[model samples]
Target: MMLAELVTTADRVGATSSRLDKTDALAELLARADPSELPALMGLLLASPRQGRLGVGWRGLTALDITHADDPLLSVGDVDAVLDVLAATSGSGSAAARTGILVDLAARATASEWDFLVRAMLGELRTGALSGVLLDAIARASDRPAAVVRRAAMLSGDLGETARIALTGTAEDLESVGLQVGRPVLPMLAATAATTTAALEITGEASVEYKLDGARIQVHRQGDDVGVYTRSLADITHRVPELVEVVRALPVNDVILDGETLSLDEDGGPRPFQETMSRFGAEVSRDLVLRPWFFDVLHVDGRDLLDEPLSVRLAELERVAGDWRMPGLVTADPEAAERLSRDALAAGHEGVVVKAIDAPYAAGRRGKSWVKVKPVLTFDLVVLGAEWGSGRRRGWLSNLHLGARDPEGEFGDPGGFVMVGKTFKGLTDELLKWQTEHFPEHESHRTASTVFLRPEIVVEIAIDGVQRSPRYPGGLALRFARVKGYRDDKSPGEADTIQALRALLRG
Candidate 1:
């Protein structure tokens, strides 16, 4: 299929706000894609080539500028040539050369051209669609059930595998499917509750571990080699070399451990989350010291412990990890656990994750199975209309408007929907500039600089406290509430329901 056709469909999807329209367009586009092309297609759809965590990227800028310049320095052919050069040079030359080519491309292109290219490169054609939507499209195009495609994709972590299976015209159920290495698995997450008392009750256990504030990690080791992956399954072995050594030093040869990676102060206490993140780039060698705290073991000597109970896994972890085990495993009574949780909070940690001793390793599942209890933090919300961001944040008009979800769903419906907060925090400066520019495009109404966006973005905010309010929607207001990035990739529809807010307030 010509790239233009895909581009046109993406354009249509972006212009239309309806989910059905977006899905239909994406499906049509997926229909024309070759099975082998799925990754490249995903890359295009996600605009992976151009997305930067910080802002509108140089390649995206180049693509936009070159496409519509009055006296263009580079032609479409030249742009393609540059991409070819980039692809070829990506792994070769110094990082400098790679950056130079992209910079040159952007310098030669126009701002409008850069904008289009940016969207294309980020594959963020926000037409209210998601990976699930794309899976449905692939299924329809191949004349297969969406479930089959989804299962294949989930099991293989590769859409190409699903497409290939679909092309074979074979009907297969995923439950019977086996695991394939390199396939992506969704990360398991914990649900949040307003209080430790409530969270403990939900789990039917008086005992729970305070969820530690650190980066979640999954460690896979074979013999002397170790690989560390984030909750997102991105291989970050290079970033956390200390973890590699820690895992290598383990008594067991072949093992897979799941845990958190934390930065430690000279005194052995946990450092800030930012300090842990700083360990990712080259600066890590100079700045931060990292440590791995094992929580569970998944594979031991080629045996998969996923089916085993957490009690068994924890035992295996303790036996094999020995000295490398995470600290503070002493059994605590309910009251003690609460005190420990409070201590964690007082020490500036996020909160505590409480776990049941007998729970199985439910890979990629989230529920009260593991509950996180944190102090309630509120924010005065401002309703900002949402616009698309890059990669996984492409569609669904994300980044959020921060009005407190009304408990009563009445009052200014302040209980209903009153806008009182807005922020571009927790984002890099690049993201800030992008949001500032794009915020206007989606504006429903405007005050001088702050656009009164359609109430779409529902940010999951974390704050220090809530207080009485007179100017906001709810009679209550948030104190020092700020964006905690976007919630574990939830849709607006799946946001914390009004009922949840009511329960929280009542508690």
Candidate 2:
């Protein structure tokens, strides 16, 4: 297939708001893709490369000076070969060589094709359907069950490879994909709820486990060999040697465990998230040892438990993890679940997760089987500025720069606002239209991509909490911030203070 075909299909996917239309567009490509080129084509459509990061950023793209071709002639294999060379470049004068290669490739693409290529390299192909939509597309093209396709993709931890197999092979081949030790499978995700009581209401007679503000880890061990991966299945076994040692100590020789790891202070309490991240990011943090807390076990003693209930997994986990298991209780009563949640909070943990006892592990997707309940703090903050949107949000103001009141010039000019962070979530199309129409009326200044607004509009923002940060002058920033709604009746002086957010970092 030509590169133009994929680019044009991506344009159609982005232009439509209908999910069915997006699935159809993707199905057409998957049905026509050659078996040999399926993996590379799927990677491009997903805006990620099988070779990982190409070491090229927006700055490198801006340095290129080339005229685009009037027509598209680059084949899928040609683009794949070019990206392979780009990924292999390293050290010395590789940056200049990368620029030359990019220029040559850019000169072979049309203007629209060039725009799509830039987004693809930037990993921001905003097609409405990625994993979920593409899963259906694969099933449609292969005449297979969606459930079987999802399981194959999740267990293999590679949607592109799964597409190639499903497209070229039989249903038996898809079913052959199973849990393998030392090969990380996608970790199961959780949905959020307002409280443990609410979460329990959804999943009755569930296990309520303590939720930690740390990193998700999937530990795969087979005898003497063990591999640790992050939520996205990136191998980080080298960074967490302590964790590797802990997993190796497990009595079982073959096991795959899902858990969380975080650094602790001298008092044995969980440390700040930033401190944990600081240690996790380092290749070696000898001073800070990360401790692992297993929550769910997928395989044990050469027996697969992914299709089993949480009760069965818990039995195996208790036998292996012992004291390392996440603290939790099994209860059918909402009141008991609430008590456990309160205990978790009293112990300085974030919250408790309520999970169905009979549900199978649905990997790589956020299913309703497990629900995470964390307390959210809402504040009326001022909108300092907003940048131009992309993909589906194009031609509108998005990614709002949030600020809190600074009455005494604690951070910015006196009486000015101090920025906490930016958020582009929780906005509907109507809200986007309203902001585009009214934000310019209050624009104090403008840039190529952003419009600075007067500190007059108050917006309600929700956050998990605040954390210590050197990026903002306020000495703290919001964690997982999202816009709740515009506070039309609130004044700038009535907005929440920076001290209010800073106080969250303590509690």
Leading candidate by lDDT: 2
Q: What's each prediction's TM-score? A: 0.68, 0.76
Off by over 4 Å in 1: 15-24, 49-117, 139-184, 326-333, 346-348, 356-362, 376-420, 423-461, 464-507
Per-residue lDDT tens digits for candidate 1, residues 1-507, read 544455567668666655566667877776666655555555456544321232334333333323344443543334555665666664345466756676776666655444545555543334444455567777777777776677566545555456556654456543344343333354556776766666666665533554555777878777777787776566778888788888888888788787887787877677766567666544346457778778777778877676677678878988988766654443336676678778877766667777666676666556666777777543224345543455755433344456544322354321135444444446555545655665554455654333555444445567655555565555555556566543332333334433334344433
The 0-to-1 C-alpha lDDT of every candidate, in the order given, reads: 0.58, 0.84
Badly placed stretches (over 4 Å) of model 2 are 377-507
lDDT tens digits, residue span 1-507, model 2: 989999989888777766677778998998888888888988888777777779997667755778899988898888899999999999899988999889999999888888888877765565655567788888888888999999999999988889998999888999899888887898787776778888888998899999986778899998888898887677888888899999889888899999998888889889865566565567675688899999999999889999899999999999999989999999998888888888888878889989999999988767789988877756779998999999999999988999998744556443458998888888888888889988875676899999998776888888888889898778888888887677543456557778767756764
* CA RMSD of all predictions: 8.5, 12.0
Q: Using alpha carbons, what is the TM-score of model 1?
A: 0.68
Q: Against the correct fold, how does model 2 do in TM-score?
A: 0.76
